[model samples]
Target: MQGAWFAFILTLLAGLSTGIGSLIAFFARRTNKTLLAVSLGFSAGVMIYISLVDMLAEARLDLLGQYGQPGEWLALGAFFAGIGLTALVDLLVPEVENPHHAWRVEEMESAAEAARARKLLRTGMVTAMVLALHNFPEGIATFVAGLMEPATGVAIAMAIAIHNIPEGISVSVPIFYATGSRRKALLYSCLSGLCEPLGAAAGYVFLLRFVSPGIFGVVFAMVAGTMIFIAFDELLPAAHEHGEHHHAIGGLIGGMAVMAVGLALVR
Candidate 1:
């Protein structure tokens, strides 16, 4: 139980990366496109590798114990179900306030001059909500992984933390622009990421009964599918929008290499 609490704290640390994003937004004069592209790509790589290699295999191990060959198929089905669930949410929720949207220099300056305060505040708040929704499953993943393995938990948490930075930017930038209150924007952004920890706590409380290797594998596959979708649908497009495809690809490879090494060491 004490270990679980400790692991849980690590998960919280991983998910609170919105705070990092908020701080960066408060300090940065402009978005660092190269950095963003690389980091986002790197996150995608970590998630993909871990989900496929470690998580899915764990799930198979657990499910095979209970259901044999049928269990393997069920795990795959559940994996698809997880992907479908996230995709459905993404589809149902209109992306009216995507954080990845870049502003042209002149457009930004003009908006600065022309926009009212309320609009920016509203935008920030909405960004928070969108990000919170996006981050819920990540919290679950971190909590579950941490509970299962401490070192792997740290790696998963780090990956999630790296991924949360952009989301923080998503929440802070608009709020700062809208209200010109750096503090408020940062606060909101940080709060938005807190949802992840909350998700972790809730998932931990409710999901222990289902925590078998097969279930883990299916969930991992589902998460992998969701991440791949986000990489292509969100991260890659955003990276390209910043005009740094090579950097993003390089980051992707680096992320994969690091995770590969971590897995090898753990095994």
Candidate 2:
């Protein structure tokens, strides 16, 4: 029970990282491209390492124990399925609008709104909703992984949290700029993270009943795939776009290396 509570908290913390970014947006006044690049790179490394070394391997082992050779194939399929599913979600969501080129937040403006400001506020709220849906399942994955293994869960949580910082920026920048309300924009960003704890709660109420080693393994594999896709498809590209950093590839390698060490230490 204590472990479960801890896992839930970790998942919540991971999801709420967007709030951190949102806060940064409100005060920082500039993008800090180098910081964003390095953080994103580091996040990618952490995710890749955990996915390959820890999650995927555990998944394969579980599949082997259950269906033997077929289990391995099943795990692989599930892995890709997770990636495809997330990509599909991204494709379906409508894009948010940002007038300012700056990716980070600058300062808060008064909440007075014209017609255009209202539209921007609506966009920000909608984007936050979309992000909440996306984050829900991720929260579940993080919580479950943590419940099963605290160390592994911590690594995953950190990776997810780091990745989420940029997402916070993505959410807050437009709304703040449009409506000139730091509080409103930051609220939307923070709300997006709530999905994680919601996901965890749902899993606890329903899926925990049927929990087994095999189930855990398959889920882990899927989570691994999900994280990898997120890292490659989103984090790496965003990092590069945010900063003209020379160490883009280096950041990737560094992320992977850090994750590997993290996994090793946990084991």
Model 1 TM-score, all chains together: 0.87
Between which residue pairs do clashes occur in model 2?
25-105, 29-106, 45-255, 45-256
Put down candidate 1 lDDT per residue, 1-267, tens digits, no spaces: 876796689868876777787777666667777887787778767766776676666666767777899878876777667677767766755566655453222334345567677876776687688777777766776776777667667777887788777777777777778877878877888888887788778867766767654555565555555555555566666656665789888877888899999889878
Q: What is candidate 2's TM-score against the reference? A: 0.87
Worst 10 residues of 2 by lDDT: 106-115
- State the C-alpha lDDT per candidate: 0.71, 0.77
Each prediction's TM-score against the native? Answer: 0.87, 0.87
RMSD of each: 2.7, 3.4
lDDT of 2 at 230: 78
